[model samples]
Target chain A: MERLNRKERVAAILKILSDNPNKVISLSFFQENFSMARSTLSEDVTILKKVVEDIGVGSVETVAGPTGGVRFVPSLREEDRQSFLKELCESLKNKDRIMPGGFLYTNDLIFSPEITNKLGIIFASYFRDKEPDYVLTVETKGIPIAMMTARYLNVPLVIVRRENKGAEGPTVSINYVSGSKRQIQTMSLPKRAVKKGSKVVFIDDFMRAGGTAKGIIKLMEEFESKVVGVGVFIEAKTEKKLVQDYISLLILNNVDEEREIIDVKLKNN
Target chain B: MERLNRKERVAAILKILSDNPNKVISLSFFQENFSMARSTLSEDVTILKKVVEDIGVGSVETVAGPTGGVRFVPSLREEDRQSFLKELCESLKNKDRIMPGGFLYTNDLIFSPEITNKLGIIFASYFRDKEPDYVLTVETKGIPIAMMTARYLNVPLVIVRRENKGAEGPTVSINYVSGSKRQIQTMSLPKRAVKKGSKVVFIDDFMRAGGTAKGIIKLMEEFESKVVGVGVFIEAKTEKKLVQDYISLLILNNVDEEREIIDVKLKNN
Candidate 1:
């Protein structure tokens, strides 16, 4: 194989690193692939890191150790994040999106790949340092964003199904009260879905009183795993929250059922 | 902005294109972003396309004329695809994945971002030319794969919930029989999830008798949309299929319940 020039090497390194986000690629891996010396590869890494940080696309962190290497951490510009969230808030304010029972219709917004992808990047960037073993979410609406977050973090996504079907083999089911509705709801997960003592991040589309989020925390406890962080795309403002210490991209202020109005704004955080 | 060298330019182009797969990016847009001439941008794209194709990472297609530009279509090497699908078959062969009603446990596999991402790339590559308006699936287990396919195709994911909730606003409901058990089931989609006259691709985690796929086709009809393609990660071999003409990566031949054996193989296609 012909040795690649610095320019070609840099381009190839960026492609490989970005594709496998948050994954550490050893210096030797790049060295052997590019047929370059350690010193040369180090120089390449420096240039790539500087360029990436300068461009505000992402950051490349180099770990110092025998087994350590460079890892790409994706990040969106603050300006870009604000603008994207503002646009999302706008799109979510349509009158027709107001459903019955003071619920706001956000399925389309949550399911749109373009919107979900950007949200994933934002959420992943926030939780990058957590280094979760998996991104967890209950089945249904939240899977898209949760999957994207897992993608960017280069981790597995474990979904806690609403009900375990026979196909799941043996499952662990738990009944939790919906904090908002105060109704008992059951959520289940296959025993093998998650490993014990693993660290996980919980993500979902909406958080109302954090009943489901609380349920997820308890569920993770059953697996002997720890929920490192909880993130939601939208969190409704309530008189009280069952679970605090969570992050939400957007805050829903109020829903006027009679007027068919929804008030949504980007969270200050 | 400072001028970036050929190496930096190529790296940036690859990142942007790969991130927005199956979407045509106009050259002028790249030119403006990179502050490069049309000729320079064209050369950069050429280098990217060649490198991508040579490495079997993906393809960069250039469309000429007024509305012409470059599009990145993701692909996996034949060797990579075969190995991945084979490993998946091995993991899925566990007898524990079999349910009492001859159903197979696949929620974990489908929910795992690592496996789902690879499957998404494969499905996206197959339907890249289909130019789907949306990627559709019934809710729950299928959401992850459908979301992934939607991500790769750069389209919105429209999920058909098993039951319509008050939060969905107005929904279109349809009754269909579960082919395997001959039980009637209802699937519903929010009225505004899709647009009329749109083309869509249906993706799911499993297909026993293709009843759900048929239900999706009927649902799309209600929306006045067309299902351009159907893709499933696994399909069980049955005496008869409710719907044909769908692509499946793996085929489940049989599950001997008494012997606790499960048989799975990769689809030749």
Candidate 2:
């Protein structure tokens, strides 16, 4: 809800595209949509190209005369992604972000196409060479970024639902310990939802105990496929345990069910 | 999932903007993501500007000089929107789009953000002026465009569920006849989910017998809110019904229940 400054705005915009990983937008197209002065946007574009490159997940390139604008290509280093996600985890602990079930409420950011799109782009850049066969996300909220990122990657999305739809198919389902609740919960994905030997990117709106992520990892393995990477819209590791090779956009620092003093952080690359 | 030609691609992108009423994109920013050569993108921008104007629901203008690009501000004439929707209905009955359930399957367009975004933009352009307080849709698939349009209008989204959730307070429940069977089915939304005096835009992924949309409309009125407009990702209206005042992005015409022939028509305007 806070207004983004020029620097943040540019970062945010680029982040949206990077996060999008779906359809790429022409720079001129963006200039038209955002309605900023051409020179200002040009300057911002220049800065974004540099920042994204420095971050190491990707590079934003400006296409030349006649038909080109800027397009972010995947060029990220794995270390950078890890560090960036680490920073993200730190920013998610804000008291305001605490929700029921010890979940870090990142509704504000996940619901934001701008922010979510950038996250998509970042992943796109991070995983470009890998080329995952599909994207996986769970029910309710994760659908946004999962759908957005799938668009960027040009792949189909398979959703894991807590309940099965008789219409979808008979399925392989799992009941896992939900970290936030420390209670086991059931979720399922259709057997045909994903194919074997294909590369996949696993993502979700939030990752606490990593139970769902791990469950999905196993489910994906059932297809005999490889997990190219894991990304979370927000990470609350301090509130729980985490595994390696996962990306978290934001993190939670401290919490108080009573006073609710909170701190938030973003993974720094 | 299908490849887009130049004109279709351009139209699709513009449609995304128009789909969300208050959404905007910077032209330069757009150019960067698509990897388009500037000149070609410029021309595409020009065409988008012109065609959208002709549609009368909005105007696409250029912010010139070093930083400027095109921006679409919806000022669409109501008559233009209505007639465009009318023609859309006629085309939907075509044979190419038929699927099971007298329903017109528009999965082709719905699956493409390029198309959905544009449709969202067009609908937003028309509905933003209506000053709707919230965008409504039934759960599962309908959530995407609903979220997109809500973001465009900078409003909250309230989703209806076929069943009640524990987190939601006492719910306002209603029933309507579904095509799945002539038998009536129940639907619900939280008691505090919507505010009174709010203007609502009803959105759905599919509209068959107009069951879900009508149920949603009734639910809103129970909250003392008005159903300002109804829009569907896909519409299969054979005969104009009392509920046809709303609009649809794609129309499904003539249905062959036995043989299964569905036709699709996109908005001609």
Candidate 3:
């Protein structure tokens, strides 16, 4: 084994911890990799913890005692978060993004991995306290952000499809009225997707009346799982909502077809 | 400002580099943040570059000359890749994964952020030399994997939808035959998704006859862009394929519906 210096050891430790975020990494693992003493490894951790905090990108927390080690929890500074949201809102204000029938052309934004990954980290930071067992999303548009959130949380992502293809194995389907169009729609989940009593956090790209959010709650009930929280990238301002008490990163105040304008900004929550 | 020691500086540098993979970071940025001299930062980078390679998780490369510094490229060792694929194939061999048709239920696996994130790094490593401008995928099942790949590659993800939704702005739609069902289907992309003369990579969860891959090639041509490569998580073994030049992580030989058997293994490539 090569004897690594303090700089090399700290770099290796940071890489390992960042690679496996939210997972406890024991000092022995570092000791084995770097051929370092426990006390040296502890000093490296201390340095890492302080630097991470000062940077405001994330943090390293000590678990304490036996069977506990260090965990990396990713986070964004408040100013950084605000600036990102501001940039997103500015991009979304493009007149071309306003489609007919009050729909905002957010497909590009939602598909952009860089933006979605940041949004996922923000969502994950908010729910890190909840320690969700799984991140759930209705299929198609929401999968990217939901997958990132699940990645940060170190959990599986369960996607409920708008239609059930037999390839998903046995499934449970549900019907819910579309909150915006008031049209009846169906959603389905595979039988083996989630375990009973699993704590799930629902994530979606857009919430327009919260009908889909309400439907997900019912869908989770079929699996005997609980939805501890709901998070959406963009929630439209609505007079009535089928579901309430959800976190939204951005709010769509209005989409004026005649004026070709979209009013979107970061939510106060 | 607190003066960071060598260990603290190295840890902070590693975290920043890992967080923004493939993006060049100047030494001045580190110097400004860590309050370290240029020579010290350079030495730290050299140490990090070697340790990252020694670990086989990834590597840090120093870009020479002015306006350049360091870049982190994530990679997986052959042994780690083989073991991960072996475990994945084993889990896929579950009897319940076989559906009524020859389809193997892989929704849960593809939806898994951890698995998908790993797969993304593998795919990104393969195509990093190509320097793809965009990663593309069709809507529904392939979003999670594509999103992760795009994230690792540090590029935007452009999703082609199965149908023309007006919300996508003006889109260019194309007709292609589904390789499995032999049914004619429509796929569309917004006009603004990709720029002309851009390089693109197509990613998907599964490949039946490579029809979708072929369609993506044709769709990219519509934007005057080129499809540089196609990557699929699982490729069904077939004598005839619509597209031949592509990469697949796993080869799914056959699915015996009656016997409830699925033969899947990691591809040699």
Q: For each prediction, how big is the interface RMSD?
A: 2.2, 13.4, 1.7
Candidate structures ordered by DockQ, highest first: 3, 1, 2
Q: For residues B102-153, what per-residue lDDT tens digits would candidate 1 score against the true structure?
A: 6777766887777887888999988878989899998788888888788888
Task: Give the number of the best model, judged by TM-score.
Answer: 3
Instruction: Enumerate the candidates' DockQ scores in order.
Output: 0.63, 0.10, 0.72
How well does candidate 2 match the true structure, expressed as C-alpha RMSD? 10.7
Ranking by TM-score: 3, 1, 2
The C-alpha local distance difference test score for the whole of candidate 1 amounts to: 0.86
Best DockQ among the predictions, by candidate number = 3
Model 3 reproduces a share of the real contacts of: 0.81
The TM-scores of all predictions, comma-separated, are: 0.95, 0.63, 0.96
Q: For candidate 3, what is the lDDT?
A: 0.87
TM-score (0 to 1) for chain B of model 3 = 0.97
Tens-digit per-residue lDDT, B35-99, candidate 3: 77888888888888888887787889888889888889898988888999899999999997777
TM-score of model 3 (CA atoms):
0.96
Give the TM-score between model 1's chain B and the true chain B: 0.94
For residue B161, model 1's alpha carbon misses the true position, in angstroms, by 0.6
- Lowest-lDDT window of 10 residues in candidate 1 chain B? B1-10
Which regions of candidate 1 deviate over 4 angstroms? A1-4, B95-103, B257-260
